[model samples]
Target: MYLDMPIDRATPHVVRESVDAVRRWEPRCEVVRVIPSITESRETIRVQWRLADGVIRETEVPR
Candidate 1:
C-alpha cells in the first residue's frame, strides 16, 4: 500500500519505494540508479538495473 506524497517530496519518495519493491520481488536483479524527471505535463521514472547475468538494462515508467 502507498499513500500520495506532496509534489515537492514525491519524486524521490516514489522512486525509493519502487526500487525497494523491485528488489523484494526480484532478488536476482540489482537496482543501479533511479532517475526521476518531471516536466510541465509529465512525470517519468527511469530505472537502471543489472541482471544476474551481468546484462544492464533500463526502463522508463509510463512510456
Candidate 2:
C-alpha cells in the first residue's frame, strides 16, 4: 500500500502511527518507498507499500 501524508511538525508522529496501524491491519504489507514532498510551499509526503499479493497501494494526506 502507498500513502501520501502531509505533515507539519505536529503530525510527524502520525506517520509512524499510521504505519504501525496498517501493519497491524495487514501483516503481509511491506513499506517500499517514502518520498517526501518538497514543492514551493506545500507539505506533502508519499509512502508506498507492497502487499503480499504483489499489489501496490498509495494514499495522500494533506496537513
Give me the runs in candidate 2 sitting further than 4 Å from their true place: 1-7, 34-45, 53-55
Steric clash pairs (candidate 2): 1-49, 2-57, 2-58, 2-59, 3-59, 4-59
lDDT of 2 by residue, 1-63 (tens): 123543354246656766777689878889776555656556555778897788888776653
For each candidate in the order shown, give its overall lDDT on alpha carbons: 0.79, 0.64
lDDT of 1 at 26: 88
lDDT of 1 by residue, 1-63 (tens): 223555446777888887998899988889998988878646788999998788889989951
Best of the candidates, lDDT: 1
